[model samples]
Target: MAFCPICNGFEEIKIACSSCGNALMDNGRIMDYYDDYSPYMPIDQMKMEDGYPADYENRECPHLLKCAVCGMNVVRLIKE
Candidate 1:
């Protein structure tokens, strides 16, 4: 099975906000924000319906990162 380092807490992403240059906070997987029940579903299953057709096939985990200073939101794809 494919696994995500960030999601599993095995690693961390350090990215600067393009607008404010501040640190971006990881807000977990983007799939979780789809609905209330999305967080409770299986990871691979959710990836299939996460709007990105290649996420499941590529085993990539999409994470939502936000900048508190500029309120900038970004979607980063992490290879699993």
Candidate 2:
């Protein structure tokens, strides 16, 4: 549901790697990964009330975009 600023086209809310020009996968919020460490927590415990975090639109909790093709990665500060 995100658009590319450079191409003005709808993209998968992720950016391609600059070095490899390969599309990146949207791995979601950074906090979600940290929440996975709890031994007693449910697997789905990190679900958000909204589709995204409250501060996500304000460029907090950046999205982690990873490129499987070339191992290049980037952190994008997204705004809804």
Candidate 3:
């Protein structure tokens, strides 16, 4: 699940930068950065693919959120 900087919960939450208090935008799925790849790949397939790493998970997609004003991270959706 995604979360706002303020800790609000939702599947697609809005967020803001903690330092600058600027609105954060959804930059799209983190997998978009991987050229010739799909986020929808099965877990087993993802593990076998090169460059994806062995620990890839849904919550660790840092590229999914970005601060629109400062270009910093604002969303706190990663599950600990």
Candidate 4:
């Protein structure tokens, strides 16, 4: 779940969207979901002793970054 910056309400949300009655933003322009996220785990140093591959993959995000795939407004670093 994420918090709405305007109303400060908690709700499930998406990374891309627009608001209908947003005071500052256009109705449905571009919104975001600020939730817990994480980058991929490094392959080299990881090990099964920690648990298992699936456990690592299913771990709650340690951090989250924006998708550079389309350039949505996010905090993630984009590398070329």
Candidate 5:
């Protein structure tokens, strides 16, 4: 099975904020924000209903990136 390098702690992704040109922080998987128990659910199961049809099929993990300076939020799809 494919796995995310960032999620599995194999690497780090640094993103710059589009609005402020500042650093963006990795908040975690996008599904973790879906509900109270989302974080505890299986990763593959969450990806199936994560609103992105291609993520599960392509082995991609969607992460929530937030810019601390500009408060800008973005969804980054990381290849697994």
Candidate 6:
């Protein structure tokens, strides 16, 4: 996990991308997984060389990060 270059606060924030404080509008609303309203493309397990979703069911998901320096929320492209 990456840290904020400035305050280093919210290091374990839900968003995978770094963020700035300003982007945070309210509490408990940082654009979580269920927020993704886009179409879902199923992942093919057979083609995966390695067993995907390692401990997925139990693993905690990553969330967005707010930048302490610029105070803007950033987005991250997640990989499976």
Model 3 lDDT per residue over 17-72, tens place: 77688777776545445566565665335434524453245434333577766778
Give, for candidate 1, the lowest lDDT window spanning 10 residues: 44-53
Error of 5 at 5 (Å): 0.6
Candidate 2: how large is its RMSD?
8.1
Candidate 5 lowest-lDDT run of ten: 7-16
Model 2: per-residue lDDT, tens digit, 1-80?
Answer: 44323223343574668888888877765445564463244323332432445543443335568898988766665554
Which lDDT tens digits does candidate 6 get at residues 11-30?
Answer: 43343223432443222212
lDDT of 1 by residue, 1-80 (tens): 77999999999999999998999999999999999999999998898888888998888999999999989999999999
* TM, every model: 0.95, 0.51, 0.46, 0.15, 0.95, 0.24
Sort by lDDT, best first: what order?
1, 5, 2, 3, 6, 4
Model 1 clash pairs are: none
Off by over 4 Å in 3: 1-11, 39-63, 74-80
Clashing pairs for predicted structure model 2, backbone only: none
In Å, residue 7's CA in model 1 sits off its true spot by 0.8
lDDT of 4: 0.26
Residue 71, candidate 1: Cα error in Å is 0.4
Between candidates 2 and 4, name the one with more favorable lDDT: 2
- Give the per-residue lDDT of model 5 (tens digit) for 16-63: 899999999999899999999999999999999999999998999999
**All models, RMSD in angstroms:** 0.7, 8.1, 6.3, 13.9, 0.7, 10.9
lDDT (tens digit, per residue) of candidate 4 on 1-80:
32223233332224442233222211210111221221133322232223234433443211132333433332211111
Compared with the true structure, all predictions reach lDDT values of 0.94, 0.54, 0.49, 0.26, 0.93, 0.32
RMSD of 1: 0.7
Candidate 2 lDDT: 0.54
